[model samples]
Target: MSARKVGMMTEDELIHVIRAAVREEFSAAGMRVDAPADVDEARRDFMFLRRLRGWVDGTASKIGGAIILAVVSGIVWLIVVGAQAFFNKP
Candidate 1:
């Protein structure tokens, strides 16, 4: 294996070398990689995911609330029925 000298490269030169090496490796392996160039596109993606999560959470909370309300209403109805049956008998 060949040896490389340490700290011999400037920052820009080092960056260029690293980018070239990555490009060559990817090209040799026949892979395609793309990076987003626009900040707006990334922001829109983040917002969409946030809205989707909020929608899911809101729907779940509504369903849970409705279930609890139904159970409480059913229990109240049964209690009313029992009270009427006991009090109206005499």
Candidate 2:
């Protein structure tokens, strides 16, 4: 195609020119430019469910870690108290 001033091109013509240039650049770089696949309702729903499950799993792990930390801290406190009482005995 002959080079033309961008200012002379209409909106559609500009888009077409840009797309052609991009495709050429991608092909030169050995990259494939495939159109995106259409996502149907079922696929969208499944994606949302997957995201929700991931969030729930992350939150559950955080809660489990906090519970474990609290249990460990309680055990440490008991050990410290017992040691102090034994050391202060008559």
Candidate 3:
């Protein structure tokens, strides 16, 4: 089919052209076009997984920070006690 300029196309023709272009792109990318219901289900699954990953990453970062802080505090306490003992030696 000959291509018509967008300005020359009716609404229906524009819509049809747009849909055909989209389908061609999808096929070229090796992607399957799903039905509406399947698309909705896939979207839900993707969102859930994304949220779960974010939560796990945040929790891990917080736990790691807490552990590092505790280790540093312990080292500081030991240094303070050692310094006091060294200065008080008779």
lDDT of 3 by residue, 9-90 (tens): 7989989889889867876876445577755765787799999999999999999999999999999999999999999999
- lDDT for 60 in candidate 3 is 100
Clashes by residue pair, model 3:
none
Q: Write the per-residue lDDT of candidate 1 for residues 1-90, one digit (tens) a residue.
A: 359767778999999888878866765766433345434555676799999999999999999999999999999999999999999996
Of models 1 and 3, which has the larger lDDT?
A: 3
Model 2 Cα shift for residue 6 (angstroms): 64
Model 2 Cα lDDT, one tens digit per residue, 62-81: 99999999999999999999
Clashes of each: 0, 0, 0
Residue pairs in clash, model 2: none
The TM-scores, one per candidate, come to 0.57, 0.55, 0.60
lDDT of each: 0.81, 0.81, 0.84
Which residue segments of model 2 deviate by more than 4 Å? 1-39
Q: Pick the candidate with the highest TM-score.
A: 3
